[model samples]
Target: MARGPVGQITRGTTGTNRLRRVDRWIARHPALRRAADPLVVDLGYGASGVTALELHARLARARPDVEVLGLEIDPERVSRARAQLELVRAGGASFAPDARVSFARGGFEVPVPGGRRPAVIRAFNVLRQYDEAEVPDAWSTMAARLSPDGLLVEGTCDEIGRIATWVAVGTDAAPRTLTVSLRLAGLQHPSIAAERLPKALIHHNVPGERVHAFLGALDSEWERAASVSPFGPVHRWRTALSALVDAGWPVRERSRWRLGEVTVPWEAVAPG
Candidate 1:
């Protein structure tokens, strides 16, 4: 069989906790917990495999038997990751077999060794370099490799992961939800999230776009709730999100908002 296209290598400047929000989200995903075949793939996990290792450690909390594989197109990057794993193991690190969080040389073709289909594929910051037109096909190709009930989480985030957004996609490659996660301590306006939206919504942030209106409403509410800023940043966010719901924005939950995140059904923000 012919190997798939080996895309351009990313800058690969990864760091610890740079993908924590997505990791936390994946760990709590129902599919990850209940998968009879709990295999997750971290596609294009940059120069360092720290994110993959961290993902394994966190997701294991929900499914201790889960297997996490990090795939990269760069062979040298894979070798370096293997060396890091060895050092971690020699230091009495707690991780599954070397197989649990192993690195593989592959591209979006998602060549899982032994042809294993993944239950969850976290491809953060992987498609930022590709044209937005390529996103849908890429999503389709990856979701096709799911083990029945799989999820393809594709999105981007700032370097430190404080401002992040992702689209949760089902096995059929249909987007189900849009989640915006941030570090709310210094939040100026929800529009700041516009800078971090996934590929689909990034270019749609203009008049006549649902995402644009959603963000506009959020910014308006944030200002209207400025009176509560004295109470605290969290209080202000809660007030703004409350206004969003009151304004029929269909915001997700207060609990999630309190954690510097809010998820909306994809229908609410899907392109017109």
Candidate 2:
């Protein structure tokens, strides 16, 4: 395999199932469900390969033939992931023996074997360390390596993965939508997701910015929906999201909003 451009090395702080929310979202994505090549890339899966293994397990439920490749810029991490794969193969781990997953040392270039581009690339918490100005170029580089109908899901989440936000970027490298997913049971406020916004808009969550206005609206709706909290957080959240849609926020479908999730077109919340 040709050496790709070396990207930044993250803290590699990975925890088991830390990416469940995003993985679930990706599993249900139409692009992956309908892809001719069901290859997914877990870009920068940290210190351990468990997240990649979990990704394979989760996505395999939707596409039994799905393949996952865990890419890390650090060679040591790649070697360690391969060792974990060996354990999985030997029945010493939770992953199935036939889990179609692999590890490689790669970065933004997304060097896949035989020049096969992936249908989906999940780059969670990868861009958090870079300057916001670099996000566009980084996104463009990865998007260029996608298959015809590929998707790039990039974002950040807390250490244990309760609250999360991600930007869905199309092959053109332009963000299509931004999704904020929270575990409503303990959600303090919908606007807390401002902290987990994708790198592109995290710093833009300030006065006069579109993202700021969006979050403010969400918080306001959350407060307005407080009367429904007697029913449940889920119902309260659904109500708030409905209010957002009613307020012309262009929120996505109710199916997603039901899961403590809300997505809006990038234009609705893009950085000003």
Candidate 3:
């Protein structure tokens, strides 16, 4: 007697630790820290539920009462995740036996039990296959299911998660910021994230768009910081980001630069 999921099934491509970058960012976000209910939704959690389990483990460090519900439109995927959860409960999986994580068949509708709105909904790699015009509707659908102060992180990452970029959307369905996270050890240029830009900005990374200009600035600063390469990639990244701030790029959370992340207000890179 359950209602059908509201979205289409995706390619379901996912991997272990593939979403680590965004998960780390979420761990420190104020939205999760101040949530009264602390319920998180891993919308369209792909072929496997491992990322959702990982999210629970990581976020639990910030709020022990946090609960994670992994939702998938594919019932077969849900069945697989439930099987994995059973392994965890039986002491045969990497996750804690008591980890507050569960899997269900759902999509943008975010059908949580008892009609509870979530504090955060992460829809990574979920909209990559959809048309650009479809994105706003999808964003609105998910954002509508959030708590008053909830966050909707929708974006993409590379195969091994070295490069990731995400858009932080609020309950109003308006994107607030765009964050690019990289593994600085061997990073060639910060512009590498340009390839992984979130769906909303990917097609807009042209000469006239704000995101393109921002990437251009990032690459220019990276080249200018070449002298800092002797210090280490982290120092070089820090220098490049400092240059952006100096150029009035509206960067946020400067402290996270050390972790190879740079977040800019969405207005700084939103499509023109």
Which stretch of 10 consecutive residues in model 2 shows the poorest summed lDDT?
Answer: 2-11
Indicate the TM-score of model 1. 0.94
| lDDT of the structure predicted as candidate 2 | 0.93
- The residue-by-residue lDDT of candidate 3 on 1-272, one tens digit each, is 97788889999898999999999899999899999999999999899999999999999999999999999999999999999999999999888999999999998889999989999999999888788899999999999999999999999999899999999999999999999999999777788898889888999889999999999999899999999899999899989989888998898998899988999899899888
Extract clashing residue pairs from model 2: none
Lowest summed lDDT across 10 adjacent residues in model 1 is found at 91-100
- All candidates' TM-scores? 0.94, 0.98, 0.98
Which segments of model 2 are wrong by more than 4 Å? 1-4
Give the Cα error of residue 59 in candidate 3, in Å. 0.4
**Total clashing residue pairs per candidate?**
0, 0, 0
Spell out the clash pairs found in candidate 1.
Answer: none
Q: Is candidate 1 or candidate 2 better by lDDT?
A: 2
- Report the C-alpha lDDT of model 1 over 144-256, residue by residue, as the tens digit: 88889889999999988898999999989999999998888887778888988899889999999999988899889989999998899888888888888888888774567
Q: What is candidate 2's CA lDDT for residue 170? A: 97
Clashes of 2: 0
